[model samples]
Target: MSESLLAALLALLVVPALLAIHAGDLLLATLTLGGYGFAMALTWAALGAVDVAFTEAVVGAGATTVLMLAALLRTTRRRSPLPGRLRWAALLVVGTVGLALGAVTAALPPWGDPDTPAAVHVSPRYLTSAVAETATPNVVTAVLADYRSYDTLIETVVIVTAGLGCWLLLGPRSR
Candidate 1:
Protein backbone atom coordinates (compact mmCIF):
# COMPACT_ATOMS: atom_id res chain seq x y z
CA MET A 1 0.00 0.00 0.00
CA SER A 2 1.05 3.62 -0.57
CA GLU A 3 2.43 5.65 2.36
CA SER A 4 -0.46 8.14 2.38
CA LEU A 5 -3.01 5.29 2.36
CA LEU A 6 -1.22 3.58 5.26
CA ALA A 7 -1.07 6.86 7.21
CA ALA A 8 -4.77 7.50 6.64
CA LEU A 9 -5.62 3.92 7.69
CA LEU A 10 -3.61 4.26 10.89
CA ALA A 11 -5.25 7.57 11.78
CA LEU A 12 -8.69 6.12 11.15
CA LEU A 13 -7.98 3.17 13.41
CA VAL A 14 -6.37 5.23 16.19
CA VAL A 15 -8.88 8.11 16.41
CA PRO A 16 -11.83 5.97 17.45
CA ALA A 17 -9.72 4.04 19.93
CA LEU A 18 -8.54 7.30 21.47
CA LEU A 19 -12.10 8.60 21.84
CA ALA A 20 -13.37 5.28 23.22
CA ILE A 21 -10.64 5.12 25.83
CA HIS A 22 -11.82 8.38 27.45
CA ALA A 23 -15.47 7.25 27.87
CA GLY A 24 -14.85 6.17 31.45
CA ASP A 25 -14.59 7.61 35.03
CA LEU A 26 -13.20 11.01 36.06
CA LEU A 27 -9.89 9.44 37.11
CA LEU A 28 -9.71 7.81 33.71
CA ALA A 29 -10.29 11.17 32.01
CA THR A 30 -7.52 12.82 34.06
CA LEU A 31 -5.19 9.91 33.29
CA THR A 32 -6.08 10.23 29.61
CA LEU A 33 -5.25 13.96 29.63
CA GLY A 34 -1.91 13.11 31.25
CA GLY A 35 -1.33 10.49 28.55
CA TYR A 36 -2.14 13.11 25.90
CA GLY A 37 0.53 15.35 27.46
CA PHE A 38 3.07 12.55 27.16
CA ALA A 39 1.96 12.02 23.56
CA MET A 40 2.42 15.75 22.91
CA ALA A 41 5.95 15.53 24.37
CA LEU A 42 6.70 12.61 22.07
CA THR A 43 5.39 14.58 19.11
CA TRP A 44 7.57 17.57 20.10
CA ALA A 45 10.63 15.31 20.44
CA ALA A 46 9.88 13.82 17.02
CA LEU A 47 9.84 17.39 15.64
CA GLY A 48 13.39 17.95 17.03
CA ALA A 49 12.31 20.15 19.97
CA VAL A 50 13.56 18.12 22.93
CA ASP A 51 13.36 21.00 25.45
CA VAL A 52 9.68 21.56 24.72
CA ALA A 53 9.10 17.81 24.98
CA PHE A 54 10.87 17.70 28.35
CA THR A 55 8.75 20.63 29.57
CA GLU A 56 5.56 18.91 28.42
CA ALA A 57 6.53 15.64 30.09
CA VAL A 58 7.46 17.26 33.41
CA VAL A 59 5.18 20.30 33.74
CA GLY A 60 2.15 19.31 31.67
CA ALA A 61 1.94 15.55 32.20
CA GLY A 62 3.30 15.35 35.74
CA ALA A 63 3.11 18.53 37.87
CA THR A 64 0.09 20.38 36.47
CA THR A 65 -2.34 17.45 36.50
CA VAL A 66 -1.22 16.30 39.94
CA LEU A 67 -1.66 19.84 41.28
CA MET A 68 -5.12 20.00 39.69
CA LEU A 69 -6.13 16.69 41.26
CA ALA A 70 -4.77 17.80 44.62
CA ALA A 71 -6.83 20.99 44.36
CA LEU A 72 -9.89 18.96 43.40
CA LEU A 73 -9.40 16.70 46.42
CA ARG A 74 -8.97 19.67 48.77
CA THR A 75 -12.15 21.29 47.45
CA THR A 76 -15.51 19.63 46.80
CA ARG A 77 -15.23 16.85 44.24
CA ARG A 78 -18.86 17.02 43.09
CA ARG A 79 -20.04 19.59 40.55
CA SER A 80 -22.51 22.16 41.85
CA PRO A 81 -25.30 23.96 39.99
CA LEU A 82 -24.40 27.53 39.08
CA PRO A 83 -25.55 30.30 41.40
CA GLY A 84 -28.27 32.42 39.77
CA ARG A 85 -27.55 36.22 39.82
CA LEU A 86 -23.81 35.83 40.41
CA ARG A 87 -23.51 33.37 37.54
CA TRP A 88 -25.48 35.61 35.15
CA ALA A 89 -23.37 38.67 36.01
CA ALA A 90 -20.13 36.70 35.67
CA LEU A 91 -21.27 35.29 32.31
CA LEU A 92 -22.19 38.75 30.97
CA VAL A 93 -18.86 40.28 32.04
CA VAL A 94 -16.87 37.33 30.75
CA GLY A 95 -18.75 37.33 27.44
CA THR A 96 -18.12 41.04 26.91
CA VAL A 97 -14.40 40.72 27.78
CA GLY A 98 -14.06 37.62 25.59
CA LEU A 99 -15.67 39.39 22.64
CA ALA A 100 -13.36 42.39 23.08
CA LEU A 101 -10.29 40.12 23.38
CA GLY A 102 -11.34 38.15 20.30
CA ALA A 103 -11.69 41.39 18.34
CA VAL A 104 -8.19 42.49 19.45
CA THR A 105 -6.75 39.09 18.54
CA ALA A 106 -8.39 39.16 15.10
CA ALA A 107 -6.65 42.46 14.43
CA LEU A 108 -3.24 40.99 15.37
CA PRO A 109 -0.76 39.39 12.98
CA PRO A 110 -1.06 35.76 11.84
CA TRP A 111 0.79 33.11 13.83
CA GLY A 112 4.44 32.40 12.86
CA ASP A 113 4.17 34.41 9.63
CA PRO A 114 7.67 35.69 8.77
CA ASP A 115 6.29 39.06 7.68
CA THR A 116 4.85 39.81 11.17
CA PRO A 117 6.87 42.40 13.06
CA ALA A 118 6.47 40.38 16.25
CA ALA A 119 8.08 37.33 14.64
CA VAL A 120 10.87 39.53 13.33
CA HIS A 121 11.59 41.79 16.31
CA VAL A 122 10.62 39.80 19.41
CA SER A 123 13.58 37.45 20.08
CA PRO A 124 16.10 37.59 17.23
CA ARG A 125 18.75 39.50 19.18
CA TYR A 126 18.18 37.43 22.31
CA LEU A 127 18.43 34.19 20.36
CA THR A 128 21.65 35.32 18.69
CA SER A 129 23.38 36.80 21.77
CA ALA A 130 22.13 34.53 24.58
CA VAL A 131 24.43 31.64 23.67
CA ALA A 132 27.53 33.84 23.55
CA GLU A 133 26.74 35.67 26.79
CA THR A 134 25.20 32.99 29.03
CA ALA A 135 26.80 29.89 27.51
CA THR A 136 23.46 28.11 27.97
CA PRO A 137 21.95 25.97 25.19
CA ASN A 138 18.41 26.60 26.50
CA VAL A 139 17.82 30.25 25.77
CA VAL A 140 14.53 30.08 27.67
CA THR A 141 16.34 29.04 30.85
CA ALA A 142 18.96 31.72 30.40
CA VAL A 143 16.36 34.44 29.86
CA LEU A 144 14.22 33.28 32.78
CA ALA A 145 17.11 32.80 35.19
CA ASP A 146 19.40 35.65 34.09
CA TYR A 147 17.73 38.34 31.95
CA ARG A 148 14.38 38.18 33.82
CA SER A 149 15.75 37.24 37.21
CA TYR A 150 13.90 40.14 38.87
CA ASP A 151 10.57 38.81 37.62
CA THR A 152 11.39 35.35 38.98
CA LEU A 153 12.38 36.92 42.30
CA ILE A 154 9.06 38.76 42.49
CA GLU A 155 7.21 35.56 41.61
CA THR A 156 9.03 33.76 44.41
CA VAL A 157 7.96 36.48 46.83
CA VAL A 158 4.36 36.17 45.65
CA ILE A 159 4.44 32.39 46.12
CA VAL A 160 5.84 32.81 49.62
CA THR A 161 3.11 35.31 50.47
CA ALA A 162 0.44 32.94 49.15
CA GLY A 163 1.85 30.08 51.19
CA LEU A 164 1.78 32.22 54.33
CA GLY A 165 -1.77 33.37 53.59
CA CYS A 166 -2.96 29.77 53.18
CA TRP A 167 -1.26 28.71 56.40
CA LEU A 168 -2.76 31.59 58.36
CA LEU A 169 -6.25 31.03 56.98
CA LEU A 170 -6.36 27.22 57.18
CA GLY A 171 -4.26 26.61 60.27
CA PRO A 172 -5.89 25.42 63.54
CA ARG A 173 -7.64 28.19 65.46
CA SER A 174 -6.12 29.05 68.81
CA ARG A 175 -7.99 27.77 71.88
Candidate 2:
Protein backbone atom coordinates (compact mmCIF):
# COMPACT_ATOMS: atom_id res chain seq x y z
CA MET A 1 0.00 0.00 0.00
CA SER A 2 1.02 3.58 -0.51
CA GLU A 3 2.39 5.66 2.35
CA SER A 4 -0.74 7.80 2.32
CA LEU A 5 -2.95 4.75 2.75
CA LEU A 6 -0.79 3.52 5.60
CA ALA A 7 -1.00 6.93 7.22
CA ALA A 8 -4.78 6.93 6.92
CA LEU A 9 -5.02 3.42 8.34
CA LEU A 10 -2.86 4.38 11.30
CA ALA A 11 -5.05 7.41 11.91
CA LEU A 12 -8.09 5.18 11.93
CA LEU A 13 -6.42 2.90 14.45
CA VAL A 14 -5.42 5.76 16.76
CA VAL A 15 -8.81 7.46 16.71
CA PRO A 16 -10.61 4.39 18.04
CA ALA A 17 -7.95 3.93 20.72
CA LEU A 18 -8.35 7.52 21.90
CA LEU A 19 -12.09 7.16 21.86
CA ALA A 20 -11.88 3.90 23.78
CA ILE A 21 -9.63 5.41 26.41
CA HIS A 22 -11.85 8.43 26.94
CA ALA A 23 -15.13 6.53 26.84
CA GLY A 24 -16.96 6.47 30.16
CA ASP A 25 -19.04 3.44 29.23
CA LEU A 26 -17.07 0.24 29.71
CA LEU A 27 -19.06 -1.60 27.03
CA LEU A 28 -18.49 1.18 24.49
CA ALA A 29 -14.77 1.17 25.30
CA THR A 30 -14.66 -2.59 24.85
CA LEU A 31 -16.36 -2.39 21.46
CA THR A 32 -14.03 0.44 20.38
CA LEU A 33 -11.11 -1.72 21.45
CA GLY A 34 -12.28 -4.29 18.95
CA GLY A 35 -12.55 -1.59 16.31
CA TYR A 36 -9.00 -0.53 17.11
CA GLY A 37 -7.84 -4.12 16.74
CA PHE A 38 -9.59 -4.49 13.40
CA ALA A 39 -8.01 -1.28 12.18
CA MET A 40 -4.63 -2.51 13.36
CA ALA A 41 -5.18 -5.83 11.58
CA LEU A 42 -5.90 -3.99 8.37
CA THR A 43 -2.75 -1.91 8.82
CA TRP A 44 -0.68 -5.05 9.36
CA ALA A 45 -2.18 -6.71 6.30
CA ALA A 46 -1.43 -3.63 4.25
CA LEU A 47 2.15 -3.82 5.46
CA GLY A 48 2.39 -7.41 4.13
CA ALA A 49 2.23 -9.12 7.52
CA VAL A 50 -0.76 -11.32 6.79
CA ASP A 51 0.14 -13.72 9.59
CA VAL A 52 0.19 -10.91 12.12
CA ALA A 53 -3.02 -9.53 10.66
CA PHE A 54 -4.80 -12.87 11.09
CA THR A 55 -3.62 -13.20 14.66
CA GLU A 56 -4.73 -9.65 15.43
CA ALA A 57 -8.13 -10.28 13.91
CA VAL A 58 -8.70 -13.42 15.95
CA VAL A 59 -6.89 -12.71 19.22
CA GLY A 60 -6.86 -8.94 19.40
CA ALA A 61 -10.33 -8.22 18.10
CA GLY A 62 -12.55 -11.27 18.42
CA ALA A 63 -11.40 -13.14 21.51
CA THR A 64 -10.25 -10.10 23.45
CA THR A 65 -13.44 -8.15 22.74
CA VAL A 66 -15.59 -11.08 23.78
CA LEU A 67 -13.61 -11.58 26.98
CA MET A 68 -13.71 -7.87 27.81
CA LEU A 69 -17.42 -7.69 27.16
CA ALA A 70 -18.01 -10.67 29.40
CA ALA A 71 -15.99 -9.05 32.15
CA LEU A 72 -17.85 -5.78 31.71
CA LEU A 73 -21.19 -7.58 31.93
CA ARG A 74 -20.20 -8.61 35.45
CA THR A 75 -19.20 -5.08 36.39
CA THR A 76 -20.47 -1.49 36.18
CA ARG A 77 -20.51 0.23 32.79
CA ARG A 78 -19.91 3.82 33.84
CA ARG A 79 -16.27 4.27 34.83
CA SER A 80 -15.47 5.84 38.17
CA PRO A 81 -13.81 9.14 37.50
CA LEU A 82 -10.14 9.26 38.33
CA PRO A 83 -8.95 11.73 40.94
CA GLY A 84 -7.08 14.75 39.61
CA ARG A 85 -3.83 13.85 41.35
CA LEU A 86 -3.88 10.25 40.09
CA ARG A 87 -4.80 11.37 36.60
CA TRP A 88 -1.98 13.90 36.43
CA ALA A 89 0.47 11.38 37.84
CA ALA A 90 -0.49 8.83 35.24
CA LEU A 91 -0.14 11.40 32.45
CA LEU A 92 3.32 12.31 33.75
CA VAL A 93 4.42 8.70 33.85
CA VAL A 94 3.03 7.95 30.42
CA GLY A 95 4.62 11.05 28.90
CA THR A 96 7.99 10.19 30.38
CA VAL A 97 7.85 6.62 29.08
CA GLY A 98 6.73 7.79 25.67
CA LEU A 99 9.62 10.24 25.43
CA ALA A 100 12.14 7.57 26.44
CA LEU A 101 10.74 5.10 23.92
CA GLY A 102 10.76 7.74 21.18
CA ALA A 103 14.40 8.51 21.84
CA VAL A 104 15.37 4.83 21.73
CA THR A 105 13.44 4.27 18.52
CA ALA A 106 15.00 7.35 16.90
CA ALA A 107 18.45 6.03 17.72
CA LEU A 108 17.86 2.70 15.98
CA PRO A 109 18.97 2.07 12.39
CA PRO A 110 16.38 2.26 9.65
CA TRP A 111 14.35 -0.88 9.05
CA GLY A 112 15.80 -3.37 6.50
CA ASP A 113 19.14 -1.55 6.47
CA PRO A 114 21.61 -4.15 5.14
CA ASP A 115 24.46 -2.56 7.11
CA THR A 116 22.64 -2.76 10.46
CA PRO A 117 24.45 -4.78 13.12
CA ALA A 118 21.93 -7.61 13.27
CA ALA A 119 21.76 -7.93 9.50
CA VAL A 120 25.53 -7.96 9.17
CA HIS A 121 26.23 -10.24 12.12
CA VAL A 122 23.27 -12.56 12.66
CA SER A 123 21.15 -12.84 9.51
CA PRO A 124 23.83 -14.27 7.20
CA ARG A 125 24.65 -17.15 9.57
CA TYR A 126 20.95 -18.01 9.83
CA LEU A 127 20.41 -17.84 6.07
CA THR A 128 23.56 -19.75 5.14
CA SER A 129 23.69 -22.61 7.66
CA ALA A 130 20.27 -22.80 9.34
CA VAL A 131 18.86 -25.42 6.94
CA ALA A 132 22.04 -27.50 6.93
CA GLU A 133 22.38 -27.38 10.66
CA THR A 134 18.75 -27.92 11.58
CA ALA A 135 17.45 -29.92 8.61
CA THR A 136 14.51 -27.53 8.31
CA PRO A 137 13.44 -26.07 4.99
CA ASN A 138 12.09 -22.85 6.51
CA VAL A 139 14.95 -20.80 7.93
CA VAL A 140 12.67 -18.95 10.33
CA THR A 141 11.24 -22.17 11.74
CA ALA A 142 14.71 -23.65 11.99
CA VAL A 143 15.99 -20.61 13.84
CA LEU A 144 13.02 -20.51 16.21
CA ALA A 145 12.51 -24.21 16.81
CA ASP A 146 16.10 -25.47 16.61
CA TYR A 147 18.69 -22.76 17.13
CA ARG A 148 16.61 -20.98 19.76
CA SER A 149 14.86 -24.05 21.04
CA TYR A 150 15.25 -23.20 24.70
CA ASP A 151 14.00 -19.66 24.23
CA THR A 152 11.13 -20.88 22.10
CA LEU A 153 10.25 -23.53 24.69
CA ILE A 154 10.20 -20.94 27.46
CA GLU A 155 7.98 -18.66 25.41
CA THR A 156 5.60 -21.51 24.67
CA VAL A 157 5.47 -22.49 28.33
CA VAL A 158 4.65 -18.93 29.31
CA ILE A 159 1.90 -18.62 26.74
CA VAL A 160 0.41 -21.96 27.76
CA THR A 161 0.50 -21.03 31.42
CA ALA A 162 -1.13 -17.69 30.72
CA GLY A 163 -3.83 -19.33 28.62
CA LEU A 164 -4.46 -21.89 31.36
CA GLY A 165 -4.81 -19.14 33.94
CA CYS A 166 -7.21 -17.22 31.72
CA TRP A 167 -9.26 -20.35 31.09
CA LEU A 168 -9.46 -21.20 34.76
CA LEU A 169 -10.57 -17.71 35.62
CA LEU A 170 -12.80 -16.91 32.66
CA GLY A 171 -14.26 -20.23 31.50
CA PRO A 172 -17.96 -20.95 31.99
CA ARG A 173 -18.60 -20.66 35.71
CA SER A 174 -19.94 -23.73 37.48
CA ARG A 175 -23.36 -23.10 38.94
Best by lDDT: 2
Measured on C-alpha atoms, candidate 1 has an lDDT of: 0.72
Query: All models: lDDT?
Result: 0.72, 0.87
lDDT of model 1 at position 103 = 94
* Clash-forming residue pairs, model 2: none
User: Which sections of candidate 1 miss by over 4 Å?
Assistant: 1-75, 83-95, 173-175
Tens digits of per-residue lDDT, candidate 1, 42-154, equal 66665557778898999888986797677667874455454699879988999999999999999887744777876568688789999999998788888888889999889
TM-score versus the correct structure, for each prediction: 0.57, 0.76
Candidate 2 Cα lDDT to native: 0.87
Measured over all alpha carbons after superposition, the RMSD of each candidate to the real structure, in angstroms, is: 6.9, 3.3
